[model samples]
Target: MAHSPSRVFAAVSPSAGDVYRDENQSVFNRGRKQTHLSAQSNVRVIEVTGCAEVSSPPDRACVSISVKNSKENVNDVTNSVTRRLEYILQTARQHDVKEENITVTKHLQRDEDLFHMQAEVLVVFLDFEKMQQARTVLIEKLDKSVCVGDPYYSHSAESLSLLRRRVCLEAVDNARLKASEACCILGQALGRPLLVREEESREWSSSQQDTSGSPLTLHPRTDPTLISASSRMFVTFELRPKDNNRRKF
Candidate 1:
């Protein structure tokens, strides 16, 4: 007779709970690794704001001239105003004022028993001395119908553009200097700039007067020709370890 074969049992299988626990631990470790890698890729940076201001003298002037006339005949009034305007234009051209700089804003003629005509002229002068001379000539040569107003001071467009550029450059330089100093104190080296932004920019005018009266009175008492510009910059710079051999955390 054949002996009965010994019964063999299968190895004990892992429980469902044990398998789930092992999978959860593996996922948790994977998440931790991803977080560590993300942290390492991000760089450390410092942010700073800098400001600068610059001032310059005025470079342009504006003068206003008004012409008015009234006569029983409309033609007479028109002719008189036209002559005065022609005289003014001729004088301006003689003084080297460009045609583009002259503007006639208003010209009106009302019809009535007594006709009336009125006109306003605006002339911009780049040369202050010529502007003064024009004013004097208009007063001396022109009749009472023509009136001359005070000069308005301002900076030319090109001058203002240059000033703005200079102020912005200064502000950026100031920000870089501050960043370098801060890095030195923290025992770190400054790396490439991460970001550069202009936060604020403005242009204004300021006036100063000389209270002390001196024998020489060539200059005006209140000088309104000073133009000022200011700018602010925000910069972010990367921070690196002073020792190049060591890696940053």
Candidate 2:
């Protein structure tokens, strides 16, 4: 089957100096016929910057739980830590947390005759409410040796990728709108896009503020723990004088 030719776009920066001269001379001034065109005929190039942000509720949480035990014998301390960790895992499983989402690490230290063993559990929970319940139960039922840390919230990889793509497209649309508006004001007609460049992209929690100190609230009605994906684009488009009658390639 035959496929349509893919369009190629080139990004050009005004500050690129000699590179611009070389390309323009090579593409537009190869022969006398092309160079003989009216000096008044020119392609107006407009560059604009656009930005967009998208937000979605966090789909995952990282809950860290620490279990520590001290005993005169190494075997005793290890056994105590293992029991506490097993109980925590059982409680988490009962709350619908999958075994794959849980990670366990063991650390053993010897201070003279005393043996200290510690187990750290990092649980990735899909449901925030269930995670909260499990955390409460662990604290209430477990001994003082078990310590639970605050939850760190985030979006799943697939969800974050979707949001990033959406914001990037939106940013491009924003650039087009700005370019069209500028052309209208200058009494010129907008032409095909010469370049579309994504300058910066970032994903952060909506509960936190960005570097500008502004709240990243893309979805105000959703939970404050939502994740926000932001993108900035630099776009350049060709412009033609409104009265010009040259055909577009």
Specify the poorest-scoring 10-residue window by lDDT in model 1.
4-13
The numbered model that scores best in TM-score is 1
Clashing residue pairs, backbone N/CA/C < 3 A, model 1: none
Supply the global lDDT for candidate 1. Answer: 0.66
lDDT tens digits, residue span 1-249, model 1: 011111111111111111101111321121222222123445555556777888767777778899999999878988999899888888888889999989875465567578888888889888889989999999999989999988877766798889889988888777777666656665676667767789888765556353232232224322445667778887766666677514321
> Model 2 compared with the native: what TM-score?
0.55
Best candidate according to lDDT: 2
User: Candidate 2 — number of clashing residue pairs?
Assistant: 0
- Clash number by candidate, in order: 0, 0
TM-score of 1: 0.60
| Candidate 1 segments exceeding 4 Å error | 1-46, 56-59, 105-113, 154-164, 181-190, 200-205, 208-227, 239-249
Give the clashing residue pairs of candidate 2, or none: none
lDDT score for residue 4 of model 1 = 16
